[model samples]
Target: MGLKKDYAALADQDRERIQRWSVLDEGEQAAILGDLISSPEMEALVDEALAANPDLQQTLLTLRIRQVQYRKTFGDRLPEIKGGYTAGKEEDTDPSYTGSLSIGWEVDLWRKLADESRAAGKDAAQQQALYQSARDTLGAEVMKAWLELIATQKNITIEKKRLGVLEKNEAFILGRYKNGLGTLEDLDSARTRTASSRASLEEYRENLARQRRALNSLLGREAGPALTLPADYPTVVPPLISLPAQTLKRRPDLKAAYLAIEAESLRASAAYKALLPSIDLEAAFEDVADTPGAALLTDPVWSVLAGLTAPLYQGGKLRAAAEISGMETAKAYQAYRETLLDAVNEVEDAVGQEQALKKQVRHINTALASARSNRLQYREKYRAGLAGMLDLLNVQEQTYDLEQQLNNLIHERLVNRIDLGLALGLGVKQ
Candidate 1:
């Protein structure tokens, strides 16, 4: 439990203990999401999923259950009251009516009840944080799927245009072979490339269909028609803004982890307090009358009682229970630390990936410009009969490949920006 205490202090350095938890409503949540997804359609889709998604709804239900459980635990601190009524006739006694009432309570001399109640409260708070985390994660997931669908559509377009170019070149090669200006080998190679390009276009189409289905599922619907989108990808990608380390506390997963540590610590305290002696007080009243109305209005007897209970011998079970709770507390602390480390690593990795992908896209753009210029020169040489058909085709293939590569890199950079925003805890909570 010493480790648990130490980790709790580390967690507290970033933020105060979670007591009363609240989440931003959909409107406010949308504002946070705009940082990563600015499209109105995407925003609307996220809102739809938040409202209709079954998994998210389940998490919310679990949070409410936890809240109810906390209230039950809190009720344990109050006195318990019971009432009973009876009517009977014995062989040697007159018909009688009776009523009894009793009240009992355990005095929390060692704050054991308080500890257990607080622990239950913390459990509820932990679930609330987890619910928010699920929500934030769902929003990011929907946006990622939308981004994938857009990129896939654009990729299919690039492949279709490429197929068109290959088919045009294949026809030119056939004409050259018919006139004895090109070898049969050159004609066959051109046809092979054209066929491969056509196959690739089909593959891209299949991928597009699958991506649409995935996005449809996220929208809480069965697969249907392809979603409508703009003819082009958005030109604007959100900037990579830096955030302070403390921003990690805003992440609901981290908040849940922190709450778990506190909850376990409180449970451990309550378990150890169970070893101490406890005091219980009880009071009862009972009345017997020949008539029901007399029983209700008059009491014939009254009694009061107090009891002290101590665990003198229980096969060391109480001590073992306390020890187990302590170990669990320590385990909870370790989990929190692990989560904290992962959060930091995720942020660093996303930032590094964004920077790396940007450099790659820049370098690819430069290479594409050079390759396109080389294709132009090769085309000129072929027209003057200075370069063979194979040489011209090879350069053309290289230029087309570079164009596709550039398209992929640009899409990848955009996706990385989404990851970066999520890592920095943007849109998670306010």
Candidate 2:
């Protein structure tokens, strides 16, 4: 099938998966949305990436070649057939014509060809798994970038608010100074804080633009139309249960590793079987006309021959090659184990991150609440002439700082939650 048709089918599958997402429980939501990489909306991005990523396209092409190789393996055991016609004329002789047909085939007495076919098939599957791994990783990164961009936009708003409050405080300080109730030092500090807020706001804007370019690149498009970020962010963290370790086994990278071992083992088997004898069956038929030194006759003739050859001394090279394949299979097995362990470690780390970030977010929330209340009090005190300009500006700065910090912590918690889902292999169906 064409990649276009395949991409459409994949997009439809994503839509179906997402359609079922709304009615699911939180845990199921995590499982389902995680596969969609945190949201149904991401389906478009992933679909575009799948169709446009050069690396992914290259993998699909390689898989196609491997499929051809697989078919050729079976073909190897089938008889090869050929047909030919030739004509020749000597100085004083009529032209002689000959036609021939031939067949040659190898009988797979040791099933080596079958083993090789299995190995080739496994290699193709391994490529598929690797492609999936790359796709999942690309999806996760795009999701993260989108989330961060949203968070940064929110931070920009906060900074703008801070700037507004600072402007108001500066005005109040100016009025107080005119009445000899504020010091020069207070005015200077107010100006400095206002400048800082403006700079931070611009910085956030710059980061936001950079992130959009990144997201566009992932979507296989140039930056033109602005990407939309969802107003609601995900916060529901799913607990890892229900044979989480088994999930690791199904991870695409791990699947690739396991398939590598299988392929290698099949190759090793084929290599071992190579030490056995091989048999070739050959048959040929020819039609002849006019011979110089023999009876000239227009006749058709046929003959068949069976040939067998046993492997003699190859100076132990074949044995060494088999041993190399065996060792590679062993290495692949160990690599699979390592991949599984790393997946487990990532899950644990994400869980740990969720625990710590939630606590930190909670604390920041409390702190943000306190800062707002304190800012209100300071505002009222300055208005009532009970507090100076310095106190009001100081509280506003504190509130501003806390708001930025709180935004960062919450964003981190959400991103880490996404990471946990990814680490658990929740981004793809088993």
Which candidate has the top score in lDDT?
Answer: 1
lDDT of 2 by residue, 69-176 (tens): 888877876789998777788898898777788999889898888889898889888988887787777767766777788789889888888889888878878888
- Tens digits of lDDT, candidate 1, 15-130: 44322222111112223655555587877888878888889899999999999999999999999999999999989989999988899999999999999999999999999999
Candidate 2, residue 406: Cα displacement in angstroms equals 2.1
Candidate 1 structure, TM-score to reference = 0.91
The models' CA-based lDDT, in order, is: 0.79, 0.74
Model 2 lDDT on a 0 to 1 scale: 0.74
Q: Which 10 residues in a row give candidate 1 its minimum summed lDDT? A: 21-30
Q: What lDDT is reached at residue 115 by model 2?
A: 89
RMSD of each: 4.9, 8.5
Please name the candidate that would achieve the greatest TM-score relative to the true structure.
1
